[model samples]
Target: MPRRHTPGHLPNDRLTELRSSVRERLGAPRPQSVHEHTPDSTHEQTTYSAQKQTHDSVRGPRTAVVIGRLLGLTFVLCFATGIWSHYLQDPLPWMRFPTRPAVLYQVTQGVHVAAGLASVPLLLAKLWTVYPRLFTWPPITSAIHALERGLTGVLVASSLLELTIGVMNIYHWYAWPFSFRTVHYALAWVIVGSLLAHIAFQLPTIRQHWRSRPSPRRGDAAVDVSEVDTGPAPIDRVQTDHVPADSVPADHVRTAGSDRRAFLASVAAASVAVVGFTAGQSTRFLSAFNLFGPRRYGDGPQGLPVNRTAAAADVLTTAADPAWTLEVRGNGIVHGFSRSELEAMDQSTEDIPIACVEGWSTSARWTGVRVRDVLTRSGIDPHSRLRVTSLQTRGGYAVSEMGPEFAADELTLIALGLNGEPLDLDHGYPARIIAPGRPGVLQTKWISTIEVIG
Candidate 1:
């Protein structure tokens, strides 16, 4: 109202003077038109708001470091236990698994499953703590940077998939078309490899930000004044300010350190709960606490949990048939044993636990003829490697191998009874292999044939 301002009609000297004055007042290096300033100003406001929001809510590097360390430790334990289980199931020629510790498999597999389950919460917490990094402004700055992000993505995906399928496998669920064992085994290596690469890439950043420190706040003297004058600053130096007492309730305030500690504590509590809920399946003493566990101790036939029942294996009719005979073949010699004939032979009793790969185990008094005795009776060398075949025509574990050491173990038996009763059809019926320190799957059920390969 005081004076009318002309646009293009202004003198060049006047326009230059005006631009200089405006630049001086705003601390900008250059003058912009109203149209140019409007969009730029709006964009800067939006960016500042977003940065402020991120600074206030996103977890600091300290939180990521702590959670990441915990996650790494848990993953290491899970990986070691998982490798042991895999080797026990499919051992290499040079590897010899111990047979003395009767409960070794039970304990190891139990720890494996429990550790894997507990890692679920830990992994989620770690991912959440570092989630803001996914939105890093310059997503790709160079080839190495692009490779680092790609590896991180692979690590996340593979870890999640491996854990998902492992839990599903414990529940006896197969939803994927690919072989669960093969894929799960292979993805474990990928997860570990990617994790190593990710750690290498982030090691410097992790070391720099591992310790918590007092951060500057908005309007604080510690903040760079030049940044404030510039309007929108990079998020790296952004700080959250405390609300004024008159503007917001004091009780609503939360310190960053306290929030980080609370989040970590919650994750720890979740892991504990998960382990407590699932570890009971293997530790019989703690079974009552495992309400969420897949299998209960004594929930199946003859006080033993059955992972695959006769009906599920489609062997009910075949296994229950009166003419069913166990065929034992060795070096050009074949011998068949009828149920009565096998029972009429010397029956010995030994307490053996059926430790399954699914992480459930139950100890029972098993009565049967010694495997060595059967091999001797059949005129076969008990020292030779043997293959035990199940009556079930279908399933991945229909046939399992017995190393010479396992076959020669005196405790190994073609069990005919459990807990002083005739074996339930679901409990491998007439005869099933029960070897000390062997996986339940390797203790082949519904024995239809035993072929000595060497």
Candidate 2:
């Protein structure tokens, strides 16, 4: 049976007032507080939650853009220098490299190695900033998006592998079974191609996020508020209509901008430091800064670093034998000269730098007969292409070719003396070919023969 009370009368139950009093005193749930009931307060709470979720889910666009730009610039520099190095090693007839400015290879190779090492940090940061995208729900928005993702994966894997192999090569560590040169060369192309595709796909997003500015808050007059009928929102989806104007404090926004600026500065400083440290190995002026570099300028035997000693090349016995004679052959004619006889000939001196593939170089005054003079003395054509062979019975670079341009260059020498002293046994003693703008490996040491092929 229910009790009915007259208008303006209290509850007929004697316990009603006591229950109400107790609930109020204990802070029990009520209809709503004045603040919570307002639209502004509801919007503020929603905006704050959405913002927090957004930050946790992905890095801001500004951070990604800054890191991406730095990585891209480094990649371009590395690729250009890498191509130059490859071409220098395996030359084609269509292209001719210069014989002047002997330290060109030194500078280029140093930059290549330095830029590569610096890119490691930049690449890691970039990947971390955008890592959330790798797990995007639905995975693909369209066929193009799928292709972009595939290319992105390729870019990441190849870049990391390339850097690993490159660093290993620098230290002369070969853990992998495959040929480093062949694989590295092939992967360079793959990386560049995939990088281009990635840029094409993300250029729009990159542009949109290049500048740092506050995004529009939710529930603004310009935005339409609507509810979705879907069962649940995707992790990547942000509800833009529920953000209040004051959800993000002005101080937080300024701090974020400052943090981004500081991060970019830190990355730039790190890159510069890396380059300075490694480039010092080749750049004499910067040698003081190469605290972590493997080799320093003006180091090794005869003030020039030796990649392989005579013993390592298996030329120790042959190179030191008194019976050693350099044979010059051309057009069915062969002329042999002993070390003494070679030294007796009219000598010319030229200052040339020995630039090695390992990115170290040193300049010295080399004294000997020019390749052209030697060919002429042997009754061979001065402009003919020549093959220079070493006393090294076994080695990949035991023999090297001298193009017509190199053969005719006045500075190309069958060097018998370095820095006005007799060539040291470890420095290609007796006689070695020294040419301008050539890698140290190609400057065949302990020379036994030179033949004109064309």
Per-candidate Cα lDDT values, in order, are 0.74, 0.71
lDDT (Cα, tens digit) per residue for candidate 1, span 2-69? 01221222222122233334454566544222122332333223232222222433355566777788
Estimate, for each residue in 1-454, the C-alpha lDDT of model 2 and write its tens digit: 0111211211111112222233445666432321234323233222322222223323444577788888988889889988988887777866677887776776777777888888987887778666655655446656776788899999999999998988788777889999888898899999999999988877755764566533454342122112211112222223333334353344444554576677677877877787778777777888888887778787876777777788888988899999999999999989999988888888999988887766667778899989898888899888888889999876678898888888998989999998879888878888999998877878999999999877
Which 10-residue span in candidate 1 carries the lowest summed lDDT? Answer: 1-10
Q: Cα lDDT for residue 7, model 1?
A: 23
The window of 10 residues in a row where model 2 has the poorest summed lDDT is: 1-10
TM-score of each: 0.78, 0.80
Query: Candidate 2: where are CA atoms >4 Å away?
Result: 1-53, 56-58, 211-247
What's every prediction's RMSD, in angstroms? 10.3, 11.7
Model 2 quality (TM-score): 0.80
In candidate 2, how many clashes are counted? 1
